[model samples]
Target: MDNQLLLSLTEKYGSPLYVYNADKIISQYNRITEAFSSVKNLKLNYAVKANSNISVLKLFNKLSSGIDTVSIQEVQLGLEAGFYPENIIYTPNGVSLQEIEQVANLGVQINIDNISILEQFGHHYPNIPVCVRINPHIMAGGNHKISVGHIDSKFGISIHQVPHIKRVVENTKMHINGIHMHTGSDILDIDVFLAATEILFNTAKEFPQIDFIDFGSGFKVPYKEGDISTNIEELGEKLSKRFNTFCKEFGKDLTLMFEPGKFLVSEAGYFLTHVNVVKQTTSTVFASVDSGFNHLIRPMLYDSYHHIHNISNPNGRERYYSVVGYICETDTFGSNRRISEIREGDVLCFNNAGAYCYTMASNYNSRYRPAEVLLYNGNDYLIRKQETFNDLIKNQVIIDLD
Candidate 1:
């Protein structure tokens, strides 16, 4: 992205804004599809939790993409964006059985991860084809918070309980159309992930009526320069071959599905915030920005690193400064990071803000959420508006006591 263009966008829109490149999103989507081209059947269901902007969903719909929703609201958003119910799969965790039934009533595919819910849903809707989420008990990512397939994680049903699952299936006579597993995010080891897939394949054999196998996606994207990321091409090459062989052994063709969130959009986003003040402390210099963790919480929440650059003074001499936010509490984005000389009112751009940044935004400290802009072709479209004061109190009711 051009530095001048980004600065001009801030001048046009405002500081503390999120801008996404549509071309980058399309290319990333194409990368995954091309990687898995060898598969007889492949489905890339864009995970809606990453960035649920209606325009984003519609763009994926335009690309003929399905959706992996975690809530009924996301399913409704997909429908509003013109996606078919069959194209949406609900894979929620710890939700109510009524909520699952509600999603099923909407005709979207239901993926049950708990045995209790599985038996209950299977008993009621035995004819409604469902998918089962299994825990392979394999840790792929290094972070325990993001990795959900470990032995103690609360994400999926245990692989050891396959006989229990089979018993429930036999009793309810429910049709199992798919089997799914999500080993977690930032997956670097292709072999470890492949080993996990072997477990999934073994589980699939237990369900003879399976039509698809969902390898829930947490494919990591590079956060900074020289950062290592998941090798999608290599994994696709190896997994496609193994999946084809498995299909032959199972005596039926099955859809190879991936529900990717970060892999698809992390690189396409940029968060721009203007420097409010440059405080020179005794030991450290703080570059306080107009925004805080309320907008981008990954740094504080997951210790995630986002590459920060001074767009307003890109050629200026680099200086080590701790970039902090205006929040009352300690909201340091990066500590002692080398960035270009930041002047008051200068714009700072945060890279890899496309995935979980804006989606995780909150109105902490009564701060309004920033607007979102989509850069498609040569034009820029405002996808979301900055919240106003009225928005803050729209749902609040005040009682007069005097």
Candidate 2:
């Protein structure tokens, strides 16, 4: 939010940099906690794959949030960030039994999706507490690419497969401590989420030994001005009342969990890039930046909208220009976008870059990845250094063919 700080970061870290505000992350976490203040048993697990930077994980650690990891590497990163194994949950999908065992060895909670791996793992480790991911057969989410709870999705076991799951549990005598469901991402409708939660709770009733139910998070954040987002306050009130009633009926206190990623950090990040050229074409004006999809690919990949501002010309006259990147491919960030007048060498800031932007960056054109900075407590800390040419060739085995 501070233009001076952004300008200073551009000067220090060079162009095409990612800067995250720790204050914003903390504020968002606090907001979620405040909304669910009435809930007796609640756990907020921060999804690590959304942004795996160790610094970012450490910030969540400071907030006392649990870590939700999708890989063994993320589990290690969470541990390196000072989170205990009990505070981490490994919810990998479509992975090998060896990989699941590797993460389980670290003492974190294991959430199995497929029946094959679950059967194998449950048979071997019957004493270990595990969670089963169930598909509620409810269609939810903002986009098809993000929706994962539908019948066609490969994410979780179908609700109709409950009999099969129960058979496996009975055969292995495995301790099924939790039930989980992740409908999708970018969900703005609170009623749909609550509907999915009701399904999860109903499924939970079938498992008497269950200690928790994970209503996988897809709480949306505003991408642009006036954009709709999940109403956490209303959802909290409605969901809490239902959850309490369910707990009373079940005669036990069960933990309510959410694995939120974008909701916690989407608005906390800013991607800054310098304008390389301002070319005036016949029908359209082009504002080419020094970066490309290599640095931020959400726009080209998902048609995601990020508010672009000419930080160097915030007060300049407004104009319509096609903001593009330097990638060799036709990587258009925005077409016919109305922003403050852009000029060569001027810096532009992309809003809502916190969640999936940097983590998805790639060196497609062999371009160096930008540096990362974390702005916390009114100070800037360099989290990751800019990639160098040597990094590109670090793993390539060069052979001299004579």
Candidate 3:
């Protein structure tokens, strides 16, 4: 995005705001679609947990991409965003059978991860089609916290439990329609993903009634310039060939589904915060901002790196400064980072902030969350309004102790 545009947004909406480029999101989705165009039956399910904003979901819905949700509320949001029931997939991990049943009632595809809930749900609703989430035991992702398919991970059922899954299916007469596996996020290794896919394909053979194989997505996106991202074109070509060959061998044509969240929206987002103070400590200089972990917590939570830019002073000389926040804790966004010299009240933009940033935000320290804007079709729309003080205590009740 141009500096003038971001500057205008910062001036209009105030600082500590989230700006998403809808065009960039569409471009990313189109890139994936083009890469996998050779595949006859393919579905891209946008993982709603990444960014559950209804406007964002509506944009994907317009693109004909299916929605992948982790909760019944998200399923409702997807429906509210105009996605058809059959186009949404509810893939919750460690959730209750009641929640699964609630989502199933929404008419969306259900993906069960554990055996206990799977057996119970199947016993109760044998005719409903369901998908099984398997743990491939593959260690992949940018960090351990983001990785979910490791041997000890609680995200998916153990592959060794295939027999038990079969038992549940046979005893309950459940219709198992799909097999799914998600290695992790920020995965750069294509071979690792392919290996997981092979495992999923082999497991799918056990269920001849299956109509699809969901190779859950973790395609990495560049957080900074020169940073490596997943080679989707290469991955699409290779995986498509293998998938088609497998279908021919199995004598059936089935859909290849992927639930991509971060890969589609991360780079399209920019978090803009204004410098509140320039504090000089004993040994280092800190450029404190008006936002904290309550607004963007990727750095504090996962030690994630987000490329920082001084959009307010892009032409200024670069220097090293520790970017901190005003929260009551040691909330550091970046430490000793090189950026255009920052001045008090100058705005800083955090790159790759679209996916987990706002969705994971909280009202910690009683701070109001920032607003959101969408840059689409050469126009800026206020997708969300900034919270007020009343929003902080909207749900709290006071007792009269007089």
The number of the candidate with the highest lDDT is 1
Candidate 2: segments with Cα more than 4 A from true spot? none
lDDT of 2 by residue, 1-402 (tens): 878879999899887899999989999999888888877999999999888999999999989999899999999999999999999999988999999998888899999998998899999999999999999988898778889999999999999988889999999999999999999998878888888888888899899999999999989999888899999889888888898899999999999899999999999999999999999989999999999999999988889999999998899999999999999999999999999999999999999999998899999999999999999887899999999999999999999999
Tens digits of per-residue lDDT for model 3, 94-163: 8888888888888999999999999999989999999999999999998899899999999999999999
lDDT of each: 0.95, 0.92, 0.93
- Candidate 3 Cα outliers beyond 4 Å, as residue runs: none
Per-candidate RMSD, Å: 0.7, 0.8, 0.8
| lDDT value for model 3 | 0.93
Clashing pairs in 2: none
- Predicted structure 2, TM vs. truth: 0.99
User: Residue 341 in candidate 3 has what lDDT?
Assistant: 90
What TM-score does candidate 1 get on C-alpha atoms? 0.99
